[model samples]
Target: MSNQTSYDVVVVGAGNAALCAAISACEEGAKVLVLEKGPEHKRGGNSFFTDGAIRVAYHNLKDIRKVVPDLTDEDAAAVVMPDYHEDDYYEDIMRVTKGESQPELAKQLVNRSFETLVWMKGHGVKFELNYENQSYEKDGKRQFWGGLPVKTENKGIGLMEQLFTRAQELGIDIWYEAAAVELMKKEENICGVAVEQDGKRMTVETTGVILACGSLEANKTFRSEQLGDEWEAAIVRGTEYNTGDGISMATAIGAEKFGEYSGCHSIGTDYNAPKVGDFNKPGDIYKKHSYPLSIMLNKDGKRFVDEGADFRNYTYAKYGREILKQPDHVAYQIYDSQVRPLLRKEYDLEEATYYKGESLLELVNQLPVDKQQFLKTIEEYNDAVQGGEYNPTEKDGKKTTGLTPEKTNWALKIENGPFYAYPVTCGITFSFGGLHVNSSGEVLKKDNKPLSGLFAAGEMVGGIFYHNYPGGSGLMSGAVYGKLAGSAAARYVLGNKKDTKITN
Candidate 1:
C-alpha cells in the first residue's frame, strides 16, 4: 500500500467505470487513488464477465474507423455496416425502458457514447468489429444488426487489462482488498473515505469521492427485500464482491434512491452454472442468448414468452424474469437441426447442460417436462409456422399463425431430426435501482440537490435504465458518465483548494 494518505480524488471500485474516473482525474492533474473490494485476482468486478460489446451511434465504416483504426481496406469491404444516428440510439433506450428513462441522463448517454469510446481508445483501450455476435453472413457479406458493431479485442478480460495498464501508466494508485465502508464527511461537504484494508480500518483524505462500486445484485438480502423473494433464487452472473457497498454507504449519508427497484438486467444462463460467477470461466460463457431462434418451454411444457418478439438484443434481459416465474424456475430452449447452424457459440460449450435426441419424442423423454404436452406444443407450433425467407440479420416477418404467445418473427418449424434442448435459469447481472445522479454525474440528495464532493458512475448511477436495457449500452453508459464524473470531480476539487485541507 502507498504510504501517502492524501489524494485529490478517491474512486471506489476497480472496474471499467472506476478506472476511467481514475485516469481522467489523473489527466486533470489530480492525485487519484482507486479501491478494489476484491483481492487482486478478482479485480474487474462485473465488467470482467461481459463480452465487451459497446453500443454507440455511427454513420458508417468511416465513423467506425475513428475507434477501430486498424481496419484494412479488404476487411472493411467484407462487411455491410449501417448508419445508427443519435436519435436512433436515444429511441432504443426509451423503447426498451418504455419511456421511463430519465430524459437528461438518456440524452447525455446517447450523445456522449461515441466520443467516450474515442477517448477510451486514446487511453489504450482496443476495439474491433463484433462480427461474431452482432452480424450474420448474407449474400457473401457480413451484415451487422442491432446497432452494435464494436467490441473490445479479447472481450471483458482484455478491456480490464488495458484499463489497468493505462491507469498504471498514468500513475494512479490502486489498492486491492481495500473496500470503502463509510463516506467521511465534514459537515455538509465530503472530505475522505473510511476503508477496510487487509482487515484493518484506515482513512484516506480526499476532496472528491466517486462511488463506482456497483449495486446490490449480489446481496441476497437486498435482492429479496428490494426485488422480491423470488430474486433470492436468482444466480449471480458477475462479481460477488459488489454486495451493495456503494448504495448503502451513499444512502447512509442522505443520497436519494432512484430508478426501478423491482427491475434488473437478468438473462437466461446455463442451469448448471455456479451460484456465483467463476473467475476461472468468465466472459459471458454462461449466457444462452440465441433463444430468439428457439422455443423456450417451461416445466408445464408450454411457451411462456414470444421467443422472437424482437431481436435477442432487445428481449434477452427481460426474458429471464419470465423464466424465474416458471414452475421450477427453469426453462428449456428447444431447437431442431434446421436452425442448428444459427445458435451462438455458448450453446456448444462443454459445460452446457443440454439434451440431444434424434427425434422429438426422444428429446421430450430426456427432459423433466410433461412428455405429452411437450410433443403437442411442438406439433401446434410446427403447423403455425408461416413460410418466408428466414433472415437472421433483420426482423423477418416469418411468424406463427395463431399461437397463444405468438412467435412474432424467425418462427421455424421443429420438424427436423437431431434436436437439442438446453436448460436455463435466471442469472441476475446487475440491479437497475441505485443512487440518483444529474447529467454531470453528481450524486443527488433527497431534496434533488447535489451532494458535495460525491459523484457516481457505472451501475451505481441509476435513472439511465429501467425494466430492460439495450444489448451493449451498459458499458457505454459507464464510460460516458465515468469520464464526466472524473472531470467534474477534478474541477470541483481544484477550484475549492482554498477551503480544502488534507490531514494525514
Candidate 2:
C-alpha cells in the first residue's frame, strides 16, 4: 500500500453515494480517498444490490434525452412517457411520508434530481429507460407509469462498475477492506478517520470527511432494539456491510439523531430468501413487488391489508411491516392466470417459493394457510370485485366493496384457472433514522449547528424519509445529497485557494 496518509477529503464507503462524493470532490481539484469496509469483490454497498431505478422530474421526452441520449425516434415512438414535474416528485415524497419529511431536504431532493442525474451521466454513468420494471404495453404503446422511468443500463452492477471506472480514471485512491472504525476529531472539527485495514489500525488525515456508509438494517440487534422485536425476523435485502458504522461513529461524536427510528423501507420478499442479502442474486430478486396486482393472505387466510390501496410504489415499503405483524410473519400473494402475466420477474425466479394449481381451491389447499378460510376469503374477494376497465398501467378505480379491507384499485377477480400463490415475509431494506443534515449536506450537532469538517450522504443522512418512501427516491436522494456533500466538503478544504463554485 502507498504511504500516502493525507487527502483533501476522505469518504467512507464505496457505494454510489460515496463514489459520487469522491468524484465530486475530485472535480473540485481535491485529493479524495475512499474507504470501503467490504472486500474488492463486495465493493459497492446497498447500491450494487438495487434495481438502479432512480426517480427524477422531467418535462417531456426532450428532458429524458438529456440523460438517455441513445433514445432514437423509433424508441421514443414506441413508448408513451409522461412528464413528472418537480411538484409531482415533491408531492409524492410528502404524501408517502405523511408530510413527516423535512421540508428543506425534500425540496432539495426533488428539485435537484434531474440535474444530478445529468451530472451522473457526465461522469460516465450510463442511463436507460426502466422498461422492464416501470413500463406496460397498453394500446400498442408502452406506457411508463410511476413517475420513475430511468435506471442505470444494467441496473446496480452496471452503475457501480461505471462509477468505479470513472473514479479510477480520475486517480482517486480507493482502499477496500478498510473499515472506518472511528471519526478522528481535532477540538470539535473533524480532522481524520481511524480505519482498520487488513487487521491493522491506521489514521488517515483529511480536511473533511464524508460518511456514506449506509444504515443499520443488517444488524439484528440494532433492528430489534430500534424497530421492535418483530423486526428481528426481517430479512436484510441489501449489503451485509451496512451495519450502522456511519450512524454509530457519528452519533458517538455528538451528531444529532434524526428521522423515524421505528420506520424502515421494508417489503414482501420470498419466504425462502436468505437471512441477509445474497450478492450472487442481487438486484432485488428476492422482493415480490407485484402485490398491487395480487391479494395478500395471512396465516389465518384473511386479507389484512388492501393490496391495491394505491400504487405499489407508494405502499410496498410499509407493507412488509404489515406482513411481519401476521402470525409466523408469513403471507401469501395470490394471483389468477389472468393477472399472472402482470407479475414482476421476481416471481418466476428459481429461488421463489410458490405453489400453483389449476384452480383457486386447489391452489389454496396447497398453501400453508387455513385451506377453508382461504377459499372463503377468495370467494368473498371475487364477489366484491367491481366491474370496470381493468388497467394495470394506472390506478383504474375497479375496486371491491363490502370487504373489511377493500382492494381499491386493480381489483380483478381470481376466477381464471392456473392460480398461483407465492409465500413471502418481511424484507428490510434500510433504516430511516440517521444523522441530521442541512441543505448543504453538512451534518448537524445536537444543538442544530453544522458540525465542521463532517458531512453525510446516502442513507447515512436522514430526515428525507419517514414512515414510507416513494420507490426510486432513495437512490435519487442519495445522488442529490451525495453531490451536495462532496461539493461542500471540497469547498471546505479549498477555503480561499480557488473558486470552487458548483453548477449543475
Candidate 3:
C-alpha cells in the first residue's frame, strides 16, 4: 500500500469487463483508475478471445415486466434454454456446482439478464438483433436462435475495441500491462489493488474497488485441483491471460466460492489450428467431412464423438473425463476431399490437405482394422434414423446431448462416396467457474451478504445461468454487472447505505 496512491475507485483487469466498469464509474462521476495486465489496445485477455455475445432478460424484478413488456413471472419462468426449464437450469447448476452457488444471487442473475443487454446496446455496442439463425451476414438475413444478434464479429474484437477506446475517451485513467498482485482490503472491505508495471511496484488505491479480473483457467493449481489429474492435458481453447489472480486474492480475503465440484464450462482438447506434432496436418483446418464418404477412427482404429453434428455442440458436451479415456488420450478426425482450402490469404498454407480418401473404401482400406467395422459405424447410424429407432445407440460413439433421441434430425446421409474426415479433440473459449453473484451483479458471501465497498463483475462473478448458455451473455454480464457495480459504488461513495449486508 502506497501513501501516495488514491482515487475514488480502482478497477483491476483491463478487459471488456473492467473497461465497462471504468466507463460506468466515470459516468457516475467517480474518479476511476483501470489496471490491465495485458498489452494496451491489443487482444491479450479473454475479452479479446471472447466470441462476444450477451444474454439477458432483466436484472431487476420490477423492470422485468417492462423489458419484455407484458411478461409475467410465469411467462418469465417459462422462457428458458430450449432444452431445459428455468428451475431445472438452476438445479442442474447447483448439482454440477455441488451446491457451491449462492441461491439468492442465482435468482437475480436470471431475472435481470435482459435489462443488462439493453444497457450495453445503449452504450453504442451494436448487438445482433435479428430473430433467426444466420451467419455473419450484415444484411439482417437471420436472427440468432434466441432472437438476438450474433453480437460479435469474432466475439469481442469490435465490441472490445469500442469499449477500450471509449474508456480512454471518458478520461478513465488506464494503466496497461499492469498485473495485479494482491487486493488492498481494510477489514474485509476492498479499497484498491496492488499492481506491478514495468518492473515497478505501485499501489493503486481507491475508496471502492471492483475485481473484474476474469477467470482462473490459466491458473495451474486451480485447474489441477478442480479438473483432476489430467487437467494439464486440456489445452487452453481461447484467452491464455486470465489466470484467476483476482479469485485467489478473494479467496484469501474470506470471499466464498461456488461451483468447485465441477466446471461451469467444459474444456476441450481440440487444436484450434494446425500446429506441430499430433495427428492431422494443414489440410484439416476447417475442412468439411463426409461420413461414409470418409472413415472415422481414433489413434486405435476407433470412433469417439459424433463427427456429423455441429462442432460447437460437440465441444459443449466433451467432459474432461472422456478426453482422458482415449488412446494417447487423443482421438483423430479423419476426412476425405483432398483440398477444402483453409485458404488463409494472410500467411502460410492457405489450404490444408490432412486426411484424404481417394474413395471411401480406399481410405478405409488404409486402416489396419476390419473395414466392416468402420462401414458398420456409418451403416448403424443411418439405420437408426431409417429404422425409426427412437434412441440411436450412439452418436459416432459417445452419448452426449448432440442429436437427441427424438430421431427427427438426420441432416445428411453418409452414403455419398469419396468421404472425408479429420480428427478434433475438445476445447472451449473460457472456463465458466467464477465468483457467485446475484442479478444486481453484487458479489456475495456464502451467507448472502454483499461485501461493503466491494463489487465484482465479468468472468470473475457467477450465477447468471448454467448449461443453458445465452449467447453474448458473458459480455452482457460484464456490462450489466459492471454498470451495477459502478452505480452501487457511487451510492457507497455518496453515503447512501450504511449496510451493504442484505439477507434474502
Candidate 4:
C-alpha cells in the first residue's frame, strides 16, 4: 500500500499553535492533518508545561468576561483589576526585549491578542482568572499584578485537552508519534511533508504546511550552538521532542531565520526535577518562580541575582541563566515564615527540594553550602532591607539599601521565624530564535518575500521574544499567529480570497 494521502493543510507539531492552526483551517473548509512528534501523553510542546496564563490585552472586567463568560460578578467586584490595554501590552514586549523585537510582529501580536483569545473561546477553549499564578489576597481584595490576570481552565494541560477535544470535534485528523522530518517542495512551493511514524518513514502530500514544532532547547548540540557554551548543561523544561525539527526543515527550504538565537525562556526549577518535564505534574508545577519573594543564594552562600529586582513574571525567565552560571549550576531560594504563606502553591509540592529551620544557621547547615558564608549573606541581606511597608501584590518599593545588587522591590526582612529554602537549577522552556514569518503567517525567504505554501506559528515562528520573556505571553503569541497562519494557509490551498478572513 502506498503511504500517501492528500490534505489542504499539514500542521507539524500538536501543541497549542498546531491545534489552533488545524482547527482554524478546518473551520475554513480545508482538510487538515496534524502530525505530532511526541506520543499522545507528551503532546502540547512547551505549552503543556506552562501555567497557561496567557498575556493578552484586556480593557477591564467586561473584556475578561468576554473570554470567561462564567466569571461571577462577585468575583469581579472583589478584585483590584488593572486594564492591560493594547499600548501596555506592546510596551511590555518592547520593554522586556529592550525594543529588540520586530516592531511589525509585536504590533500584530498585541493588536490581535484579545480577538484571537476570544476566537479560541469560541472554539471551546475556556478561560478563568489565573488565581494561583497571578493573584494575591490583599486587604480583603484579590489584587492581580503583572498585567497577566487570566489563564486557561485547568492550566496548561487543560488548555491542550480542550484544544485537542475541539480539534477532534471538528473532524481534524491528528497522528501521534508522527514527526515531520522534511518538507517536500516543488519549485520553491511546499507540496508535502516527510514524517516518521512508528519508526517508519512516510510522505503525505499537502498544499500548505504549518511548522509549529517549537524550538531547539531540547537538542544539546543546538542548545550550545545557538544559545551559549553552557546551555547544553541546562535542563529541558518542556518536551525532549522539540529538537529544532521545524526550524531545521523550514530553513532547509530557504526560510529566513530571525530573532535572538542566543536567548530563550529559562526558569528556576527544582534541582532534582527530571531532565524533561513530568507529565503528572504539568503546567509549571516543577518551576520555582517565587524566587522573587525570596533571596537566591549560591553554593558559596552568596547572593547572586537580585531576587526582587522585579515581579516574578518579569525576572523569572532570565534568572535561571544566572543560576545555571552559578557554582554547580545550582542555587537555593531562601525565605522565612513571614513570606511562607505568600509563596505560590508550587513550593508545597512533595517534589520540591525544600528545607526549613527555625534559625537561619540551622537551615544553612541542612543544605550543601558554605555555612559561614550563608549565615553572613543572610545577616547582610536582612540588615540591608530598608524599613518599608511590604506589599506582595505591587512594586511596593520596599528596597534593600547598600547591597551589592539591591532587592529593588518586595524587600522584607527574613527574620520572622522558621526559614524555608529550595534548591533550583536552570530549566529552559523554549528557544527565542526561529523562522521569520509575516503578519499573514507566511514564512519569509532570504529576500524577505513570503515563501509559497509555507506557514508557521508558536515557538517555531519567533521574533516576539528576546533576551528575556514576560511570563504568559508565549501562549498568547501562539494563538494570535496560529490563527493567522491557518487562515493564510487555507486561503493559499483553496485559492479563495473572498470566502476567508485573510487580507492582502
Candidate whose TM-score is highest: 1
Q: Which should have the higher TM-score, number 2 or number 3? A: 2
Error of 2 at 258 (Å): 0.8
Candidate 1 TM-score, C-alpha based: 0.98
Q: Which digits, one per residue and each the tens of the lDDT, describe model 3 over residues 1-504? A: 223467788887876778778778787888787777766644435666554544444223344333334445564453322222345434543554446556765555545555555565556565542222222222332212222323443345667767766776787777777787887777767767788888998777666778888777666677777666565655554455678787777766666675433454543334334221111121112322222122235555555544334223222333434544565555444432232222122112334334446566776676544578666655555454443222111232222232322223222344544554444444434456677555555666778787666678877875544543434445666776788787777667545323444321
Each candidate: what lDDT? 0.93, 0.91, 0.54, 0.88
User: Would you give me the overall lDDT of model 4?
Assistant: 0.88
TM-score of model 3 (CA atoms): 0.72
* Residue-wise C-alpha lDDT for candidate 2, range 77-112, written one tens digit per residue: 999998999999999999999999999999999999
TM-score of each: 0.98, 0.97, 0.72, 0.97
Residue-by-residue lDDT tens digits, candidate 1, 362-457:
999999999999999999999999999888899998999998999989999998889999999999999999899999999999899999999999
- Write down the TM-score for model 4: 0.97
lDDT for 281 in candidate 2 is: 82
> Over the full model, what C-alpha lDDT does candidate 3 score relative to the true structure?
0.54
lDDT of model number 1: 0.93
Q: By descending TM-score, how would the candidates be arranged?
A: 1, 2, 4, 3
Better of 3 and 4 by TM-score: 4
In candidate 2, which residue pairs clash?
Answer: none
Clashes of 2: 0
